[model samples]
Target chain A: DAGVTQSPTHLIKTRGQQVTLRCSPKSGHDTVSWYQQALGQGPQFIFQYYEEEERQRGNFPDRFSGHQFPNYSSELNVNALLLGDSALYLCASSSPFESGYTFGSGTRLTVV
Target chain B: GESVGLHLPTLSVQEGDNSIINCAYSNSASDYFIWYKQESGKGPQFIIDIRSNMDKRQGQRVTVLLNKTVKHLSLQIAATQPGDSAVYFCAENPSYAGGTSYGKLTFGQGTILTVHP
Candidate 1:
């Protein structure tokens, strides 16, 4: 079975521009969660989606939004990107039986 | 803000030496714990996990120990190797928070591990 896969392995965007990242969950998984990892820092929870609906969100502002498709694919969108938005965006997929999450390679976003 | 923090920023050890990384979490309600390893420029990968009910869980060369009494969590690597060099993070999940609570992971500041030959 394939693990979580993310698209646009690397992205370069300027400040105030918007970007969308995509992720495909592993086989048989139904939950998708997003995280932001800054340099030398651990990942911070952005939000989680289940059943194609956002079930929870982190401390991030309204600028960060996400969508989960019925097939368990997910997309993370950032509006008016800031320099601070530059980081490794990780997509983790998991199921209730398996609390341990499997993370994708991640999309590296660099906001200049 | 509630957070999971590490006592050390970096640690170095020779190959074949055992390594231990520590983490402290402020949220006592957190019932689930996990440890992840992230190489430079890579997403965090699951290493091992221990539930609140268990005090210790061992996997392959990695072992995770959770101390609910002190709200402390630790990852122990036996016979550490060069491949073990990476940033280690501890995460906690507070079940009481409710809603999409299963996958949510609050990570620690992270400890960078460097293994020398």
Candidate 2:
């Protein structure tokens, strides 16, 4: 009955460094997707993972990558972070049968 | 180049008043549309959704109306309250794109709604 859960609600990172954010999807869900939201803007789709393989991706650069474990959990990794990388990273999970997706509280990444 | 967009950047209304947020989408092939509300420091929450076949769908206190002719969609909140204040976004899915991108959503810039008590 647990909703999507993300780790390290907030974090601070310096430029050129890499960071990894984790997410535990809602029970009975198998699909995981990541999104990035900048200040005063809506979230932009990053990529989606289904069955441990990346199925769909947005217009993000190659520096942004993600992985889905067998248990349906996911991790988003951003390499060579820039100040512009500072934003709220949200994780959402959905099932193939459902029309709506559920989102986690999100991890706030601050690039210094 | 197809994208979703909102008509208003911000909206402020007094409590107990009805509120309407509008959005326009360029992808006519998008058959599924959804509305999401995001609070400060939180992820977007699903509010309601409508498909191309249907013109309207109603939720608890929210309603979504889809006009495929003009490629416009609307979310109406009845008796807006302070808790209703948040940034609203409209998302679309191009189902005809193929199976691999079936659930992929393209989101709008969002409309900020402020309900003053």
Candidate 3:
């Protein structure tokens, strides 16, 4: 089965511009979560989406938001992006009842 | 706030030698833990996981050990290969927390493993 897939493998945007990264969870998975990984750092949880609603969020600012579609696909939107927002955006999928999660290849966003 | 951290930022092991990466978590109530391997330009791949009740869990060429008392976790890789050279991360899920019924994961700083041939 295909694993979690994310679009726009790499992106470049300027400060104050909004950007949206997309993710399609692995087949048969319903829950989708977003993470941010800076260079030489581990991925940090941004938020999780289940049942089309944001179920949980990390300590990120209001500039970070996400949505889960009925098809189990997800989108992470970062508004008023800062240079610090330049990082690898990873998408993870899991079942609510299971502890294991599958992650996508991630989208590398570069803010100029 | 609680967090997970790694003791070593980088590890160098000879090819075919076994490798061990360690992590410590501050959340005592975390019930689930996972180990993920991430290669360059890729997302973290699930390597293994262990629950609070289980002291150890084994997978193909890998093992995860959990110490609830010290709140420590470890990942052991046998017969390490060049492909195993990557950053390893440990994540914990605090199921007992008041929010997030799905149990969100908090990841460590990651350990970079370099397999030297």
Candidate 4:
């Protein structure tokens, strides 16, 4: 089975511009979560989408939002991007009953 | 103020040698723990995981030990290979309730493991 897949492996955006990253979760997985990994740092949780609604969120700002579709795909949108927003955006998928998660290769977002 | 952090920022070892990476978490209520290995330009891959009830868990060539009293965790790799070189991260589920509820993850800063051939 194909693992988690993310589109636009790499992206470059201007400061203040908005960007949207897409993710396709692994088959048989329903929950999708987004994480932001800064340089030399581990990923920080952004928010998680389940049942097409946001269930839990991290300490991120309002500019960060996400959506989950019926097909289990997900999209992460960051508005008013800052240079600090330049990082790897990773998407993880898992079943609610499972303790482990599968991750995508991630989208390398660069804000200039 | 809950957070997960690593004790070392980097580790170096020769190929075929065993390697160990350590982490500490501030959340005492965490019930589930996971170790992830991340390669450059990639996302975190699940290495292994253990619950609060279990003190240790082992996989193909990796082992995870959890100390609830000290709130510390460790990952050990046996006969490490060059391909095992990557950034290792430890994450915890602070609100793990079991069943069909998915818990959020709190990740450590991560330790860079270098396996020299």
Best by DockQ: 4
Compose the digit string of candidate 3's lDDT tens values, residues A83-105.
99999999999874555889999
Give the candidate number with the greatest TM-score: 4
What tens-digit string does per-residue lDDT give for candidate 1 at B47-104? 9988788999999999999999999999999999999999999999886222233747
Higher lDDT: candidate 2 or 4? Answer: 4
Fraction of native contacts, model 1: 0.59
Which runs of model 2 end up more than 4 angstroms from their true locations? B96-101
Which residue pairs of candidate 1 clash? none
Q: Which stretches of candidate 4 lie over 4 Å from their true place?
A: none
| Leading candidate by lDDT | 4
TM-score of every candidate:
0.95, 0.95, 0.95, 0.97
What's the best-to-worst order under lDDT? 4, 3, 2, 1
Global Cα RMSD, each model: 2.0, 1.8, 2.1, 1.1
- lDDT by residue for model 4 (A1-112), tens: 8999999999999999999999999898899999998999888889888899999999999999889999999999999999999999999998866668889999999999
- How big is the positional error of residue A61 in model 3, measured in Å on the Cα after superposition? 1.0
For residues B1-117, what per-residue lDDT tens digits would candidate 4 score against the true structure? 889999999999999999999999999988889999999888899999998999999999999999999999999999999999999999998777774537589899999999999
lDDT of each: 0.90, 0.91, 0.91, 0.92
Fnat by candidate, in order: 0.59, 0.52, 0.59, 0.68
Sort candidate 4 into its docking category: medium
Relative to the unseen true structure, what is the C-alpha lDDT of residue B58 in candidate 4, on a scale of 0 to 100? 92
Q: Which wins on TM-score, candidate 3 or candidate 4?
A: 4
Number of colliding residue pairs in each model: 0, 0, 0, 0
- TM-score result, candidate 1: 0.95
